[model samples]
Target: MVKVLLILLVIYSFSYGKIITGNWSDPVTPIMADYVKRLIHKAETENAEAVILTIDTPGGLDTAMRDVIKTFMGTDIPVIVYVYPPGARAASAGAIITISADIAAMAPSTNIGSASPVQMGGRDIEETMKKKVINDMVAFVKGIAKDKGRNEEVIVKMVTESLNLTAEEAQKQKVIDVIAENINDLINKVDGKKIEKNGKEIVLNLKDREIKKVEKSLKEKILTILTNPTVAYLLLMIGFYGIFFELYNPGSLIPGILGTISLLLALYSLNIISINWLGLLLILAGILFFILEVVTPTFGALAISGVIAILFGSIILIDPDSPYGDIPLQIIIPVVLFSALFFISIAYLGLKAQRRKTPTGSEGMIGMIGKAETDIDPEGKVFVSGELWNAYSDEPIKKGEKVKVISMEGLQLKVERVKDGSKI
Candidate 1:
């Protein structure tokens, strides 16, 4: 009886202890991919029975997505992708990942699909580009489906045709294996299922198992935030303008410093996302043109061209469908318009200031010829407009002889004699 109890205790220990759990929401940035790879390695080294991947994302970087898929495929542990809570979605890359799991499950009110490959900026790709993208995506999803023993044809349809479905429909069509309302239900349903890992079959024993969640590290969190489209765009704009402002008006270090930091952050983000360099160049050109409009009057021609270039460049900067959907047209249109208006206003103000007459010091006093009211010699005192000044003149003049102040040096005024009968 003691031996029996010992055997049961050993069974329970092996069944319940060391369950690994991971969460992925953003369609897997490079940082997230690395994190997941590490977690999988840890699970394998520790001989964890299950690696639970909780998902809630609209999808993300394609390269990162492929990296995650490779990690999942190579792991020697059962990976169960669970779409949790109400209203959660496993769209785009998330759907492909979900289908790649050993066991795919979702909570009530969750969804999956819309696996179309859009332009990097989330707009519809040109026909040629679209064909290449569609073919690649279809091939990828089909491979995942085959590996996980899901329906390849349906996966292809989903990717090529942009099909979406409720969790129930997905499960019914055999595209997904299960549909559980929560983690507990998932645990119960998958408890006795068999999965192959490291070429060996192992049955899951998740009944009463403790679930532990592994979160992204702080570094990963920061990288993920930087990869966001809105944040990335803002950083790019701030960096560009800051540096430009600093260069335009030297000795102001604040803009330069801020610009450097923003640019660095934006570059890091662009490295992670699919960015077209041509679009970046166009944006730079647009800024240069706008600045030229301020420096040299172009009658709004340069400004108009700059605005058009900037708008076009921004629209084409990133392929919306690449992973993160393109920047919404609504968002891009307004930003372009506002940016154009801002630069134009600055140009107009600059032009107005340039055209205005000088208003300070000696420049303001140039045309005001004053009369000397006292006798003037090369070094004599004179009264001009109620102020006494050291006066100098080549011609000797009697007291009260009218003399016109011609120029000034320090506190002295140089004068010329007023001819007889000439206007003083």
Candidate 2:
């Protein structure tokens, strides 16, 4: 009677319960870590049968990644991390995460490994420090692998030698439990797998369970966009352009205000992206060079160099190994080309404006030719630039005689004779 009752209870629990799942597709940011932690917490609170995380990431910040691993370690629920879909990979921090899960599984066409930490953001680590970093990672991964009953030596190779493994090979080597083609298949394979989690052994009741996905909240969606490398890069460009336009044409309140707002937004992103000071300096230098090109004649030399500098700086701005560093080449190419064209256009326009006839102020009268409307020995009324003004000349001015404005004083134009309708 007790056995039948137990079986009936299990059936009831499977029939009317939630099987929680989450898809982590972004580079592992702190926010991503938080998201996963929340999902785990929610699952635990609701007495979920299991939590399946479908992960596809190129890796991300080390601190955030470790925090996620820590959360997995502390969670009472069985956390099954699956590297899913074809052609997907669990790389860098991702590899560690998969290995650390209570049950690590992968799809047929997926891969795992490549957890080696490369120098990002700045220059290469000093030799002594590099050894220390590698040792630390090796120790950390080895510990996780040991606890998870994964092959520690081979896992060490992932960090030391940057080794990668196909899903089939991984399953054969016991790195992953199974190579499931889909969630249903995965459930069948891992249905009764006993795993140790949260200081106790628990069975993953994957059979016939309802899969409930924890969708990202609106805040997380916005946060994801803000931390995106491409989005941040574009924001940075917008900020630069806005400020440049405002500076170029001062008192244009709209551009200045817009620039300030964009800059603040960009700065917020940069903070999240983790600013590399050297990279930031290089970007600033590039802008300075472009501004100097507009002010001084450098034959487009400064402009070209500035574009190159900005391109290189932006490339190195985010850590190369981090998710933020992987801005596509397609984006970089267009941005560089656009920046060069913009600077050249702005500089050309600025120089042209300098050479143009002045429209107002004392210097505006120079080279302006007009007809004298009233006769005078040294002063007269003259029409120039569509406006009549009092004028003076070293030479006598006569009525209806064409006069060339050579200078201006106190709203009066200094004139020279325009004999034969041409200034002599």
Candidate 3:
């Protein structure tokens, strides 16, 4: 009886569908793509009534955008792309993603469009290549618009002429299905709306439904941080410095461990964002120069070269085409300057201090001038280094004569008679 009751309860829970919503505020990177895929999969597993994705992005990598769209299309449940918070935008690739959803929605005062493709550094492609890319993107967007029953003609203008549309304009032009004030308004407006997916019509029953807001998992948050371009570059630098400090002062486990971890995470992040090989090599060369500056000071020559190389390298390290964007000049300039200073000033002094010989141990007894308390031919007791010890000398030392400690053997000191006694 209990087993039967459990099965019925499980069925009852799934019968009343729940809505799954996620906020996407970052650029569409591999991490974002993965998150969207997981979000949709979670909805499918839970048999959700719908999935609402609130997006506010400046577009991102083409590949990541395509992955997100693919994930949305493959799912059986309805996917709604909502441009929310009134001041948000669905610019560039975001426009296409917005239109590709089963139900495209936007909050008041929001806008969408500008889905044109450009080269790295925001430069336009050559005339020949320009047409090819434009045509390709046009067909992709038009196809999606046609499938979603949106206005294909107006939507394609977003690619051809970089046309943008306000929420009201989008709604009027049939570019978007709904203009909602908020999530609740969107739910109430689209409630019982019918949309065709894979040749089957799906009715959205979102009114008064249980809404489950999905947030990034801890692992996802960490990956998101690692994938940031600035953060990744910082991690790389930290790794280098940590390892450098560890090499200078061995057995200081903390720096070495932190450096290793930071470096590995940096490499992993670099893998996700496309990087220029020349830029990376230049940065490495700069690091090498900085290290050389520490080992062999060149009166700022090596340090200057290192700073220049690092600056150029950092400028080009991130691919211009990367959706994650470039490292800010403000960060780069200060970091390069600080790196040069650290390598030359702190590194040199610290290393010198570490290499300096200690003067407090038994070796400190060497070169000390002390008076011989007892006179002897070969071995005599002498006071040196603030203590009395048995001393030996090749020459005879008279009582009360000055002697210099040359070396130490066990508890005794090897001394020599000072003809002209001078305190050392």
Listed in order, each prediction's TM-score against the native is 0.61, 0.60, 0.60
Candidate 3 residue pairs in clash (backbone atoms < 3 Å): none
What are the runs in model 1 whose C-alpha is more than 4 Å off? 1-16, 272-424
lDDT of 3 by residue, 1-424 (tens): 9999999999987698899999988766776787787778778878899999999988867787898899888989999999988999999878888999999999999999988998644678899999999999999998999898899999999999999999999999999999999999999999999999888998888887899988985445756777777888999999899899989997554566457556756776677333365467668878877887777666666677788778866875664334564588889999999999899995679677766756766667778889899985899899876788998899988888889888889898889988785433
Candidate number that wins on TM-score, 2 or 3: 3
- Higher-scoring candidate on lDDT, 1 or 3: 3
> What root-mean-square deviation over C-alphas does model 3 reach?
11.2
lDDT of 1 by residue, 328-399 (tens): 668877887887788888888888988775654544433444565565656677666567777888887656
lDDT of 1 at 44: 74
Residue lDDT tens for model 2, 396-417 = 8778888888777788788988
Displacement of residue 213 (Cα, Å) in model 1 is 1.1
lDDT of each: 0.75, 0.78, 0.83
TM-score of 1: 0.61
Q: List ranges where model 2 is wrong by over 4 Å.
A: 1-16, 121-126, 247-250, 272-424
